[model samples]
Target: MRLAHAHSVQQSGAYVRKFGAAALLLALCSSVGVIATSGTPATAAGDATSASRARTDELTLRTGQTLAKVKASIPSGSYAGAYVDPSSGTLRVLVTQQAKAPALDTRADAPLELVKARYSLAYLEQRMGEVFAAREKLNGKNSRIVSVDVDEAANSLQVAVDGPIDAALRGRITRLAPDTPLELVQGNSFAPQRYAGSRVDDFAPWSAGVFIYNKTTGGGCSSGPGVHVGSTKYMVTAAHCATATGQQFYQGHQDVPSVTPELVGTVANRSGYPNLDAMLVNGNTANTVYRSWYNFYTASSAPWESLTGQTVCTGGAYSGERCGLVIGQTNVCSDSLRSCGLTIATGPVNTVAAGEGDSGGPVYITAPGLRYSGIVTGPVNPANSITCLNYPSGLRSCSNAIVFTRIQNILAYFGASLN
Candidate 1:
């Protein structure tokens, strides 16, 4: 189950629901052959426009390869920080202990720069864990936290509390990790959404934008990318979209009129928070697939191994297709303080990306030919409200933001493959 997704969705009437996602198709790049070659400094800044564009292009092409090689070669706890900086058209690396950072010989041939940070990456992650634990103490009314964002840019672990942070709670967070940056903001928490699926006997076209269902619970959700484990077909979706596995899988919705859907697959498996919120719908020859994949989302196609400043576009039934930028990563936890998981952060896209019943849609990059990426995870509200940004909007852009799960982790977890 190579994870590829896009979209923002909420399952109506469900308590522990899953986040929506994008379903991007994996398209290979021709220049992939040179991903290993170190980038030459851009020519004298003539085409401030052309020169900048060239740098960005180079950054996108090499970020993934460079990051992968860095992650693979670095020691456990040595990976201080790494990000794709669109502004500089370079990959930046932050080291807590400069002497312990990876040797230049280990870096791939990408446009990269290195710096030093006050804290080690591992320590910050550990502090974030403590902050999540502290958030569990807050009652939903006074200081409920919706999400915890990892802001490497600010070198802080941001906590998005649903409301204002009281004095006592503030002190606790401050005391937990005195040196750690634990910033808080306000926003409404998520709720369940309606408009999703059920199974049918006839053979209906199982394409993107259709509904999906879990037979046991009879709940409805949208379909994402049409994938296959070898020749076996599957519908990649959020694990929470369905309640139980080993049950029958259906399409479209019996509640929504105007048409019918087919019995395309079965609830093969699922995993909730703490792990990736995704599942595989095992379909067979009986399933009819149409334009079941991404449309012209990117200029071409690419993989999901890069991040930070990279762009992520998504598609859903209600919102259609749209593109957004990769901002950062986010972590979400439940009341019991158990179901904790991290997701790829994006959005406030300039297009309608996700909508009601659009869970498990599709997401990719649009410029380099709809390069496939990962699935939609959830939404986040910036720690600040002065800026009316972060809402999914039109091509002109508006306030919006989105979160998704990386396909690299998805494929590695499910042991699946894609082009």
Candidate 2:
């Protein structure tokens, strides 16, 4: 429910029918590998080398050029180090230092090394500044602060607190350290939930790669990587996904297989799209069966309460199958727009992180194998910014939380049952 990070690209709303063959092929060809943390084994021999190596590879020189000048041709961060091969008229870039050196075959058409060096150096400096600023603000906090841990990969800070604090305290902490990934962990014992993978087959009836063709926009689309609900055959996704309005979902790397969605009879009656951005696809047939185990519900009713220390998770196209803790909720109503409630959940935000493609994805909480939560309606207003100050209230809107839609209302509107 938290607005962790905004999508840099604007929403096009352009729905295309063709499946992304290129993306699907890339996923199929690439090996499925877990991210190797700093201490983990290098998955491949080149892995370690690539990690430490400078990116600059080949640089060419006509005449009368010093090694530093040639090195400047490559980007600053391209390689950890470099050397000039005077005989070959090439500048060799060393990427990593391993027991065995990597092969650097320079060809005539190699690019200028300086370009890479300059860009990488600038990028590294910018990121370091952000990290340093976040740390300084956290150090000045006066509350009963518990512990502060830095997520190096995410470049954010996770702060644990003793108990619930007022909205004022939350705002101050966020304002003091705007760039840091500030997460408020409740009791000393409770740690935020980390992402554990899910099985595609367990959510039966709705196969992970099943695609639905949208007549509205004439496009084929699939559900993003999340639990799909309904009679095993039928699945649910954002109405945008079902409608294919520039919103397409992905499972791993492959696009969900497309089928002419059964629209009129059982399909039309059961399939639900509450508004312009929501949709449900029915896959129930004679042979296909729905699995109750896959579905879930929300904890609160419509117009939810922003209770501090409350925990929640959302299973959707972007956040994929991850869960996090909720830090803020707000009721937004206006003349043109009705009261659209928003809840913010936070953790490590990713790319398919949550975008137009993730609409209609389920946002639910699970206690191991027990009760499952429900689907998210939409993201919070002031849409994409991770941290924003509410002008009138002077409170920070989810500086530490992500926003989400209330699920119970959506479920009730569709007349669907959840366990």
Per-structure clash totals for the candidates: 42, 53
Compose the digit string of candidate 2's lDDT tens values, residues 1-419: 21111121211223211111001101111111111111111012232123111111121111112333444444334533333343454444432222222222233233223211222323433443443345435333444444443322233444545456556655756676554445555423122322222222223223322223344433233342222244333344444333222332222222222321334111232122222123445433111111122322221111122334555554443334445555443221111111123334555443222322234445543321112233343343223324333211222222222344444333433444331
- How much is the lDDT of residue 113 in candidate 1? 70
| TM-scores of the models, in the order given | 0.45, 0.34
What lDDT score goes with residue 397 in model 2? 23
Worst 10 residues of 1 by lDDT: 34-43
State the displacement of the C-alpha of residue 46, model 1, in Å, after optimal TM-score superposition: 59
lDDT of each: 0.47, 0.32
Give me the runs in candidate 2 sitting further than 4 Å from their true place.
1-12, 15-204, 207-234, 242-278, 285-308, 330-342, 346-353, 368-370, 381-402
Q: Give the TM-score of candidate 2.
A: 0.34
Candidate 1: lDDT of 81? 68
